[model samples]
Target chain A: MAYVSEKKEKGIAVLSTATSIIVPAILGVSLIFTMGYSSGLIYIIGAPYQLMSLFEGIIAGTLVFSFAGYIIGSGKTYRLFAGLAFGVAMFFTVYYIIHSVDYVVPNGLLTVCSFIITGAFLPVSQLATVIYHGRFLRGLAVPAGISVISIIVIAELAILYEDSGQSNLAQIVTLMNSVTLVALILMLFVLISRKSSGTGRIQN
Target chain B: MGSGSLLKISVIIVVLMFIIIAFIPVASTSGVKTQGVQTVELESDSGTRTPIKHVINIYLENHSFDNLFGIYPFDSYTSNASLSANLSVPLNLLSNRTARDMLTEIPSGTFSTKDPNEGYVSYHLDFNHGKLNGFLNGSGPQGLTYYSAAQEAPQWDIAEQYGLADNFYAPCLSESAPHHLYYVAGYSPIINDYGPPPYIPYSQSIFGELSKYNISYGVYLNNTAYRCASWDFLYGHTDYSSHLQSWNSFLNETSDGTLPSVSYFFSQGTGKSMGPPNIILNGEMLLLYVIDAIEKSPIWNSTAIFITFDGFGGYYDQVVPPVMDGVQLGLRIPLMVISPYAKEDYISNTQMLVTSILGFIDYNWEMPALNKMVDDSYLPLDFFNFSDCRTPIEFSPSAGFPVPSNIHFSLVTNTSADNYSSLFPMEPQIPLDKLGYNRTGSSSVNLSSMGVGILNKDEHGYTPFFESVGFYSMLVVLEIAIAAAIITRYRRK
Candidate 1:
């Protein structure tokens, strides 16, 4: 019976995430594909990089969903953490795959940089979008927002200096992970403090 | 507006700042070219130009050059980046930006533009042999492995029965998939959908044609071994047979042929196929079994077996795998073509592998070796110096005494993970538990402390494999620790 319920929960989460990413992905791809028809108009309207941003949005949205599913998934101790780790790792793996392709056109170096940016964009967007959904994760929101902003700052600087090296992107992601960990810790500390500080209400 | 939110934002900012700080060094190397990609075409000896009738390919894992971290005895562990630097070999190996227009034909006797500084540093044979021998005696250094010669580890005749392709290498000396692809396709691409539902054909595979012709191929697997399994498309469909066998039994059974014309065999988990082999000598033993077959089979006459690896598994090596066709070959994985016709004391300075396998078939059968093979040739048979005229010849098997130790190579280790005390004494190195791993019908146990691997061999050497936890645990442990510490600290106020 528990197994059945667990399966159901997983199914629903999958359905929801798919529904979310698929709709936007389709719309984004369509928007992207249509712009090719009017290259001049698309370029004028900033559609060239919009496609990149939309992808970032989708990744962010997906990561938020994964986070929610984990916190809500119940069962076991750290399903959410597992999911987050997996989702991010998978996200980066995809980026590595893009960077690895040999036959990429335009310029291999540029392609690699684009992939790194695209990868960074996803995590940033996820935190930005998910922070609000955490339902006043209260003080947690501040740390989360700063984390994203910091990443963008780093990214901008990296691009300014040059974003072609593998380590630049790697360092950025590694910092993001570390900060995220720190923020989560801080939020947990705040939550426990609140619970014990004479307020007899559980925030969840 | 809240201080909490401000704090959170500040932390994020700090993290990003650190990333930028870390990236300063990387950005400093701007405009540094990453070398160039190559497409090699080796020439075959003309006099004994018999078409390829039989080809056997073997893929061993993680055991680059030598088992340990040295190329000679008593050498220390090294940090060669050939096996697994995570950097895509194509980008890291070839300078596409600078050498985009330059078309330099690959010279013969060299595999890729091999940088002698990119792979895992391997200890010499003396180190490997001495270690294994000592470990088996239970009197060795007890370093990493205890797979001494006396451990009854499966042994086979290499270097002697086959003309050793000394300069042969793994496509990339690393992970399973890319190397496997190179084992069959010659080139390893960075694919998006690399895992699951093996038959999902996002790209071209040579096995497609082999399957189309009913040439006969099979994957002897355990676990969910069929990821990105398009190799089945080459044969109408693929079969997962030989699912369960004792390591000893499988070795004994498989060396004599109970199979098809083109068979793809891999052991599960720790039993050789999916391990770094510093722990279990599964990969080496498995190769030995294949060697045993070629050394004592009727098919040995007309048969040739090529052994190579796929990608460098983010380790290290000195010989950077070459770029064949377009993809980075990864690193100098060990490659050997076993046959009577192969060079006796041969050191083939050639970049040949899966594509070469396809090249062999394509040249002999008049088929187009897809992907890289289309551009490359079956690693030219020059590794086999055919000074005299010869037609396609076939050899008979099981003719000799077939001693297992004719060319003995045993595994040993002094710093077994069971006790890396000499290395990291401050770290509590309890034999960590390898949880949830087992073979078919075997009870699960903690593999870490058990002095065994993912598949612990029993007295008779029958072992089952289990699903790897992957990196799922590290995150969990960290999460729990931080959660606990944070909760305690906040409550203290």
Candidate 2:
């Protein structure tokens, strides 16, 4: 029974960690690919443009996050399954964006900016995990670094807005910021609850 | 508080945030503001007059106003013009409508879609008594497709720099033939594209009227000088055949200062029309060439160039056509007035038709009106500012993207086999010296509430939390402390 409980805790840690890292990476790469394809910076044929970018982003993101997971000492099998599950979750997240999010500018800069900003969730989640492990400064550093990167991204979006007067694109920006903030708070809550419940430490 | 108490409160707060996020709609952002008034006052101009001597009408093929300019200056990622510089607000997909509402009624259009069904009868079905919801049934989803400013760089650039008429309707609710007839004559006897012998029995025409007053007019066709033969066939008169000129002649005339008092240019043959096998890139290129030629000419100061489509070509437009004189008006088509006297970044909401061109001509030359409709039609004088002659704004001809090898047309041709470039010879290039000016400057402009002319601060400010550098700096300090703690813990492990 002790062994089973330990195995369950390990599984949960691997699953949550992989999900926190991989999903946002997929979304980030997807937005980049989409921006490139729409701007005519990238050439692709034979499939629908949006679908092709999404598929390519998933593959690239999966490969990248898998390496990161491996470096972090996660089990190979756990990382693989978690990657697949989170990839599917990211696909649905993009689908929701397509169906629900409106006010697309011709250049598609707004949608890409929003999704890239929402990608802050990855670092925020990492920060929570590190804090729960009693490495408060290290965890705080991760989000701080991400925040600086986000500022640069937002500055570019602001320049684009100034040039275009495309206030409509702001809808996606607001929606994405709200999602990222909520997810950050929720991740912290989940981590705090786990620590208070005397849950075993995440196996690094 | 104990860690357990802190955890409980955090969970509750997180849940509430998620619920709030879920309920927030994506369309809660600011939208384009429009005025309810019909006309707008120009920045420093009070009275209207005309400096237009040469009237040039460059007529292209089918496309509705909404099909091309649904978002107008905001159609592309770049704002082409300012809202303030624009005297009048245009009615587009973004006007008074949320993005969700737009997606529900008429989803955003895509590029490379098949051209939709368009004709006299089909247009009425699409009209659906002004509900404007019968596009799917009347012409299929293809009709609902619209081009972004990225795809229509030339049109958007010209409209933003000059004047765009959003409420200009086609004189007839039919295809190219009748609309063409309405252009030369104030009216069309037939409702559709085709009819019996003497397709247009209306002996009276704007061309004949010009000939009667000996005002000098030319019909320049782009394909070949020979296609002008159709003019005789359509009108049953060879009287104006002498006035028929080739595209090359038209360009040469602009520079030679021998351009006719009135000129009607058609790009039907050179694939410059925006119909089936819709090659908008070629159309844009053709327009740039024409504008470059005109702007460089001796007649540039005296010329007022009107660029418009002959018909809507079965694209989705939300506004229903109004009825007049027991005949229903046609779909809304885009109209741009380009001249030194033309209003800058202005949108004219004035209800107008093709006959308005005749009205302008009559008003300009002090000639009698062509007919009652021409007499009643609103003159395009409102689109010009006689008080101040704005210098000719140089527009870049670069499409800013690689042109597609070809655009496919599923309606009229076999898409798999018909490549536009391969089928037609490359358009003849005008001499660089003839253009007289080098194309410079980026196509984008800084747009505020009222576009380029007025510099109002943007109404939608940047995200507050994201733009706070101070907050981010604190976060960086916090992050550094956490990283050192992490290293210490790892060393112990």
Candidate 3:
């Protein structure tokens, strides 16, 4: 009788985990599409520029969520480092692919890719972290906090550079790249320190 | 899970979305006041005037006064004398007096393959504190370039027949986007920018005024992505969306004689003769089609067409624009007023701007001024003397003109006689050419043999492609994607 209740509790936890991630992913994707459509992308011929930026955000979010999930689910220091490294590599690769392409990929293909990445991969990865850790908000919070801070800092630097009469296009680009690199290094250091201290690792 | 939790989650999401949307700054329609102040009165031979029932504003893209209308034959007595006399006082001056002599500088058949840079910063640099000679040394390759006499033959022909405002200028020194915003709304606060984000709200516009009076108005766009149609302010408001229709709807209405009291026509952004990268001849042909439709319609007698360009697209013009309230007026642009009441072969040397159209609309409809700036500017009613509405003006459409083969070319190496012939075709030979005007100087270019290209087949090429797979398809795709996502989520559960 105790064993049956234990199995039921595990099942209920899995269901709860699935519900949490799936609902948010669906809501996020739907909100993004609605915003794009209502913003006059419906009348435009090809994919509106706004959708492309939204796609980049989804790609970055999926990478962070999945990497965090793998690190938390494994509950090992080495896995945490490995996952962080993989996340960084994937983020840069996706960014390079999006920026360097000369020809436009069809909007439909882009939409489908974005939807699959956000809806399927995001939920599955988030569910892993949620099930093992009983909550994944801490893991999610770290990356979200980092992203928000980096974006705000980058935006401020850009605005300041624009306001400065002496700054030119090349100088601004260089400044942004330097700031991004420094931010990346700082984030990696934080992740390494947390892993070494065994602060985020789950105990069996 | 229980249905109660699902309901709570949905409600929470809905409330959150509402909160975010509510913070997005809705445009206040309360602040704008209509002060009934009459600025300019029309001077006409007859004391009584025929009521103008319809006003059609057709806005074209980039071309300067000296570039398009430099060589247009002007009556020196009326244009020069009136402008000189009017300059003593604060009356609007005509174009012929303001424009610099380009007879020696720009050759008869000059052509360029390169497009000039006409960004906000570039325009400011080119202005050079109103010296106006910095075009050549400015940011772009074709900044100093002007359309030759041969290149401007089509527009010149129209100007000769209709009422042309030689001294008309763009209201602001900016790119197409801001200029377009200024066209519908007397003021555009968001200057020097483009895009879907930072959508402007409908706080101030001629449309809002028209709505108050219950006057009918429609904005017809050739391309959906044109700056005016893509304006977030209009799209965001449900009240104005129905009034925004396709360009074809305008044509159909003209044919059916069902056009609204006030109609605005915006050309396609590219390949429709908007200049720079696109061929200029394509734009002329589009204008011709609109004119032909209007001329053929029964509403021709009652309708008045105000054709003008939005701003100078980095073209060389010798005139230094006047400063108004710390902002330098943009360079001189070509303005033509076509109506039964428009003076025949008459050049009105009045200084006009995009605001003139709004002023005329306000005057005819007995509506209040859009704002103080518009109220101060000269109205275009001076272009028309309603003493002669009994006889309509006759316009011969330029038929069988060969469309330019190359849509894109550089100014340096694109000196083909064939490309030049597209502007001045020999077929249905131009009346000006018959009246001893040699369009092709020394070059022997045959226009009859040259085959029509993409432009002749369709003025706006592949425009139907968007119409065929339009908003419906977009919605369908959205619906399918959502359904698939929902199904996938359920299967995962």
Interface RMSD for candidates 1 onward, in order: 17.3, 18.3, 16.7
Name the runs in model 1 displaced over 4 angstroms: A1-204, B1-52, B66-157, B169-174, B191-203, B222-259, B268-270, B277-280, B372-374, B385-493
TM-score of each: 0.40, 0.49, 0.53
Q: What is the TM-score of chain B in candidate 2?
A: 0.67
What 10-residue stretch in candidate 3 chain A is worst by lDDT? A39-48
Give candidate 2's error at residue B375 in angstroms: 1.2
Per residue, candidate 3 scores C-alpha lDDT tens digits across B1-493 of 3334433453454355446435422322121111111121233222112457779998887777766665454323232333223221111222434434422333543443356655554566577768775665443546554554355655654555556776678777766656766677665543443332223344346765666556777888765544453244332334456888877788789889899888988775555645656666567657766777788787888888999887888776777888654556888888888887665444665666787677677667665566655565567765565755634433343343433333222223233452332333122222332322212111111111121111011111111111122322333233323322222222222
TM-score: which candidate is best? Answer: 3
Candidate 2 CAPRI grade: incorrect
DockQ-based ranking, best first? 3, 1, 2
Ranking by TM-score: 3, 2, 1
Count of steric clashes across candidates, in order: 85, 16, 13
Candidate 2 segments exceeding 4 Å error: A1-204, B1-49, B79-88, B96-112, B201-203, B224-234, B397-493
Report the Cα lDDT for residue B25, model 2.
24
Residue lDDT tens for model 3, A66-90? 4455445433324433543443344
lDDT of each: 0.35, 0.52, 0.50
Candidate 3 or 1, higher TM-score = 3
**Looking at candidate 2, what is the lDDT of residue B57?**
93
